[model samples]
Target: MANLDTALKDAMSIDGAIGVALVDYTSGMTLGVAGGTPEIDLTVAAAGNTDVVRAKMRTIEMLKLNDDIEDMLITLGGQYHIIRPLTGPTGKGLFLYLMLSKARSNLALARHQLRTIEEQLEL
Candidate 1:
């Protein structure tokens, strides 16, 4: 299993990866971050996304859906944002956030890679 630094580095190796972060959903804090350009502040993005996760969780609870979220995808004109909540006992309340350039990224492969990284992550 990899530690946070290795996990973040692995995330940055994905095709078209622009940035990645390991964030805490409850506290809106980033545990680790990598690969963001100056124009893209990963820290701010990570914190802001905590609300997105929280909202979705709240919606699921209110709707009484027994399902769990695997991940969330946001497609922008030039970018794809993926939010994957960690599920292992040590990873609860945290998520892996990945940003990719739409033109260069293979969505399916990136998702698969993220899943692998999540599995190997040691928290």
Candidate 2:
């Protein structure tokens, strides 16, 4: 298993990764972060995405979907945002948020890589 710093480092190594953060949706706090260009502020992005996660969870409960969120994707003109809620035993209210340059990333592969990172991440 990898510690938070190591996991963040691994995430940054992924192709097209612009920034990555481990966020706590319940409190809208960033537990750890790595990478970010002048164009992006990973802390702000992570906090804002907490709303997205909360809204989706509320919707699921209200609708009685009986489903769990695996991840949420937001695609922009130049980037792709991936929000994956951690499902491991110790990761109850946390998520992994990653931003990738659309032109440089392969969405499918990125998703796969993120999943692997999630599995290995030790919170």
Candidate 3:
């Protein structure tokens, strides 16, 4: 199992990864973060993305979709942002956010690898 430090390091190792953070959706606070560039403040990014996750979840509940969100992908001109909410008992209300260079990242592979990392992460 990977601790927060190990998991953050592992996230940084992903191809094209620019930054990664573990955030609390309820409070829009970051629990852990790694690899952000000077132009990107991961703490701010994580907090903002918390709203995205909350909005989606609220929409789901309102629509009575009876579903769960696996992840959210936001593609910008040069970046790919991935937000994955953690679902384990201890991980509830927490999420993992990953930023990747669109030109270099394999979206499918990154998603798969992130899933693996989530599973191995020890909260």
Candidate 4:
């Protein structure tokens, strides 16, 4: 099983990965971070994405969807942001946030890779 540091390094190995973080949506705080460019402050980005996760979860509850969010995607001109709320007991209220370069990333593959990383993560 991979520990937090290993999981983060695994994420950075993904093609086009610009940054990755483990964030707590409940408190909008980051537990770990990796691979951010100088132009991107991963800590701040992770914190902001916390709101995105919380909002979606709230909407799901309000709508009585009887479902869980597997992932949330936000597309920008040059970037793709992926927020995947962790499902493991130790990961409740926490998520993996990934930022990829749109030009270089294969969205499907990145998602799949991230899922694999999540599965192996020991938290």
Candidate 5:
């Protein structure tokens, strides 16, 4: 399994990855982060996304949906934001947040890569 640093580096290797972070939604804290520019602060972005995750989860619970979320996607004019909650034994309560340049990224491949990263990540 890959450690946090390696996982983050792996994430950064994606075609258009601008930044990535492992965040704890429950506490809105960033456990690890990599590859952010001056225009984007990965830590702050990760923390803000905690609200997105929490809100969706709460909505799901209130609606009594039996299904679990695979991931959440937020598409911007020039960017794509992906929030994938970890499903592995060691990943409980944590999520992988990735930001990509839409023009350079392939959504399908990015999703697949994130899944693979999730599986190998050791927390």
Candidate 6:
């Protein structure tokens, strides 16, 4: 299995990848980050997204839906933001956030690649 550093590097290699981060929703902290530009702050983005995750989770609970989230996608005019909540025991309360250029990325392939990386990630 790959460690955090390797996983982050692998994520950065995805076509059109701009930034990625491993974040803990429980505490809104970034455990690792890579490939952010001057205009994009990975840490801030990750922390901010914690609220989104939590909100979705709460909505699910309130609605009494017995389900789990795989990922959430945000489409901007020029970018695609992918937020994948980890499901492994060791990954509890954690997620991987990836940013990609809409013009350069193939969304389906990027999601598949991210899933593979998540499977191999070792904390």
Model 4, 1-123: lDDT tens per residue? 899999999999999999999998888889999999998999999878887888888999999999999988899999999988888888888999999999999999999999999888877
Residue 6, candidate 3: how far off, in angstroms?
0.8
For model 3, what is the error of residue 40's alpha carbon versus the real structure, in angstroms, after optimal superposition? Answer: 0.5
- Candidate 5 runs further than 4 Å off: none
Query: What does candidate 4 score on TM?
Result: 0.97
Q: Per-residue alpha-carbon lDDT of model 3 for 31-118, expressed as tens digits?
A: 9999999999999998889889999999999999999999999999999999888877789899999999999989999999999899
Error of 5 at 112 (Å): 0.4
All-Cα superposition RMSD per candidate? 0.7, 0.8, 0.7, 0.8, 0.8, 0.6
Q: Write the per-residue lDDT of candidate 2 for residues 1-123, one digit (tens) a residue.
A: 988999899989989999999999989999999999887888899889999999999999999999989988999999999999998998999999999999999999999999999999886
For candidate 1, write residues 76-102 as lDDT tens digits. 999999999997878989999999999
TM-score winner between candidates 2 and 6: 6
Q: What tens digits encode model 6's per-residue C-alpha lDDT throughout 14-99?
A: 99999999999999999999999998888899889999999999999999998988999999999999999987778989999999
* Structural similarity to truth (TM-score) of each candidate: 0.98, 0.97, 0.97, 0.97, 0.97, 0.98
**Global CA lDDT computed for model 2:** 0.93
How many times do residue backbones clash in model 1?
Answer: 0
- Please report, in order, the local distance difference test score of every candidate based on alpha carbons: 0.95, 0.93, 0.93, 0.92, 0.93, 0.95
The C-alpha stretches of model 1 lying farther than 4 A from their native spots are none
lDDT of 2 at 76: 98
* Alpha carbon lDDT at 104, candidate 4: 98
* Residue pairs whose backbone atoms clash in candidate 2: none
Question: 1-123 in candidate 5: lDDT tens per residue?
Answer: 999999999999999999999999889899999999998898889888999999999999999997777999999999999999999888899999999999999999999999899889996
